[model samples]
Target: MQRRARTYLTGVALAVMLSGGLTACTGSPEDEGGEDTKAGSSGAPDSSAPPGRYRTLPEPCGAVDLSTLKKLLPDAEGAPQGSSTPGKGTASGDEESPYEGQPIATYDTDRRAGCRWKSTNSLATRNLTVDFERVVSYDPAVSDDEQAQLLYDERAGQAEIPTESEPPADEEGGEGGDPADEGGKSGSGGSGEDGGSEAADSGTDGKGGGEGGGDPGGEGEKSDSGGGSDASEEPGGEPSPSSDADLSPRTLDDIGDNAYIDDQLDTGDSGVHRDITLVFRSANVIATVTYDQWLTDKRRTPDSAELQEKARSVAEELAADFDDN
Candidate 1:
């Protein structure tokens, strides 16, 4: 009887082991990680945004064309230190040997890279710095472009550029040189100066300038007449009483998706110098061009028009290059 009991127990144990193996082969709901796993997930809709348009940044040191470099930095063609240039190097480091821009030091080249170039001449000493930043969104809900825009807005705010109050484009009244408005204003008195009024009137008198075809031509000449950007050799070339409105830091419409320019003047041991900076945003990347000139001659101030134009040109070139890529 004892032997029979031992055999029966062994058979029951074998049967139990076989039943467990069959259950394993059938698989559990959780084991498959299919429907069960999916159901267990948070089940929330994905609000994630698309990544930035640019995945990689260009090499900052090599991004600029040689011609542009030469134009901005006169000494780029290889000016020996103190080649009749007024002051010593404005930059902290030794002058760049051949004037190739010096790359800014950054741990992450993928996210940010910069190049700085300095040039000196008897007229004025100039420094140029170009920075490229690739924005990334930490929160899935925010996009790279949106994040970059926010950052740009912040930078612009810190610049202390006067708000759009001085701008005629605002609702209160800076119509941005409407030809009709120009006609009315000049009609009162601006028409007297044939050089200015005639040009403005002709520009406004229906020239295929889009809706405001004549507005640009007319206003540009008005500004020119007032010597706004081109402070020419006119007897009245000194900044007009209204020149503050023209020289004030203002937003630019023709550059990138959005852009602005800041101009500031400071007087110190180095005489009066002008600092012009252009900041623009393209997709998820932000490029900044900072060009400033220092003159030792306090008798003559640096011309805003020349520096502003050069800075804008560099910024525009950088923007165009970004678009191409």
Candidate 2:
């Protein structure tokens, strides 16, 4: 009887201890999963970033159409191969057709590619190159587009082009009309919505008159004064030589997602040559078009406006093609 009683007491004590241990475990750290911040397979945030938009780049050799090539390069009587063109290689190879550009060599076509075309005429030697780059992000936390944006910004900075906020060549001194505007009688009245100067007398009418003063003529004189006398005209009205700031390298608003034009007139021993480069980015791809014109006459400078226009035209076409395909 004594032995059986001891056994029952021992069993009761063990049951009580187990009950207390279970109660403590219910409120322990392991049970509070909802409050836990630790990351596990299912609980961790995603590390993979979004993929780039472009999987492949366009054919660099065919980026510019034949019509554009003809417009940019010399049409006839190109200098013999291995001539004085700076970028043109002097390899003793067969003469290349101006219509077909030589493909830029690269080990990985998927990442980057480019092409070059050159032609020479009595007037000038023209060289055009087009390049394409596809950016891939190495970090899983950053998307390819973000990586591309960073790279493009760095290049733009390195180009040393003026910021958009900087005044153009035209506005460097005082902001006003160009010389062409000064020659006209526009100084007699405020900007005319009608050729008849309808607003000239309207200022007298309370409803349609000028905002502050009723005299529109005074407004014209103020604008003219702000611009000073025509910079293109001398004191005696002689046609003085003029330089416009529109030719300066500046950021473009509409070529691509982000774009800029770099205009440089190099007057070196080689000769006077103007280079206009247009660079733009779309999605994860970047495109660059470099148009070079080397004038045969060193005395005359290559027309910056003309080169910039041509480069912009090519860039627009390339961008449109990218959108279409």
Candidate 3:
């Protein structure tokens, strides 16, 4: 009986310890309720971040239309091939074929992509390249247009083209009136018959004198008028400003959201080559087209009109593709 009673007391002590441990492990209902409430009240996450305009980019090689490519690179060996696959010389045995145009591979397809094509004739060669870039703004406080404008400004600066800024008010007001006033003065002077008659009469009177004093005076007036005309013929009638063509890049209006063209000419013993680079921004994407042509005849250079026309066509096609996407 004593042994049994001792066992029962030991069991009761163990039960008390287990009950206390359970109470400590489990918190009060109020505390549990508070945690549940806190989790529920967290609500939705902050979504104030401004979204980027472009989420994806088009295929680099296929961005430009095949017909356009054919026109640009008429002598090219074959259709363009993508760099996604290995060229034939590679161990993979999937190397790009000689017939396939050159593929300009980029590390990131979603951000940047480009392709190139070249064809050589007996005496000349032609090359065409196209690139596409997707712009993404990281700043949440800035809008897409603002971000795009900033990027465009940077590109314009690099191309050495004019930015979209208002002309100085003073310059506008002064220059705006001068041309109109000069035109009016010229028109009135031309139409005034009385002045012409007076001049003619004076000339006749001077001619009557054997010394011909009027002839010298008339020649002097004619020389003075010729000099004035030459001055007026100059750009804006002031000392002619330097032409920006060879020195600075040119901005193109009516092309994409903004556009510019850069022309570079390289002359070597073999021949002269001209490279025309055209860049246009549409929405959050920028498309660059480079057209290069080599002429064996040193006297000949690539046609600017043809190059620009082709480049603009390719750019438009790329922009359309972006729109479709």
lDDT of 3 by residue, 122-194 (tens): 5456666667666665666554545555566555554345566423334334345678555433332222212
lDDT by residue (44-88, candidate 1, tens digit) is: 335678899999888766666666666666644444432211112
lDDT of 2 by residue, 41-95 (tens): 4444577778998899888766776666555554422544422222232224565
Compute each candidate's TM-score over C-alphas: 0.58, 0.60, 0.54
Question: Relative to the unseen true structure, what is the C-alpha lDDT of residue 288 in candidate 2, on a scale of 0 to 100?
Answer: 82
Alpha carbon deviation, residue 273, candidate 2 (Å): 0.9
Query: Which ten contiguous residues of candidate 3 have the minimum total lDDT?
Result: 220-229
- Give per-residue lDDT, candidate 2, residue 185: 26
Error of 3 at 261 (Å): 2.0
